[model samples]
Target: MLVLITYDVNTEDAAGRRRLRQIAKQCVNYGQRVQNSVFECLLDTAQCRSLQNKLCKLMDPERDSLRFYYLGKKYESKIEHFGCKQTYLPEDPMIL
Candidate 1:
């Protein structure tokens, strides 16, 4: 499945700044960041739930917002992109 995770953390204080960094770090662990606060992650049900759990713990409901869009297994045609960055399938083989 392709999971699009987006978040907004109130960075008006030191604690909020720290929370933002921590959230970004965790997102990087699970996927590629396509935007400042948006990530494209390919994960299974269990993995998605796990990531959600981790994020829930990191965010303050009153001060932060998080969203997850599940694109299921056939997500290719579901997404369209246009910009500088080229899009690639998460399952594509990398020869590096």
Candidate 2:
């Protein structure tokens, strides 16, 4: 499945800034970043749940926000992009 994850972290303090970096780090391990705070990850059910749990624990519910959009296996037809940033296929091979 394709999971679109977005987050908003309050970066008004040092701790918030740290959280933002930590959150971004975690996201990068699982997927590609589409925007400053948005990521597109291709993962199975178990992987998705595990990632979600990790993110939920790192986030400050009172000050941060998180969202996940499950696009299932057929995500090609579901996503449309028209922007300056280059788009990528989640299923394609990634050269690290």
lDDT of 2 at 30: 98
Regions more than 4 Å wrong, model 1: none
Tell me the tens digit of each residue's lDDT in model 1 across 1-96.
999999999999999999999999999999989999999999999999999999999999999999999988899989999999988788887455
Compared to the true structure, candidate 1 yields what TM-score? 0.94
User: Each model's C-alpha lDDT?
Assistant: 0.94, 0.96
RMSD of each predicted structure: 1.2, 0.7
Query: Once model 2 is optimally superposed onto the true structure by TM-score, how far is the C-alpha of residue 88 displaced, in angstroms?
Result: 0.9
Candidate 2: tens digits of C-alpha lDDT, residues 52-89 = 99999999999999999999999999999998988889
Question: After aligning candidate 2 to the native by TM-score, how far in Å is the CA of 79 from where it should be?
Answer: 0.6
On TM-score, the candidate that comes out on top is 2
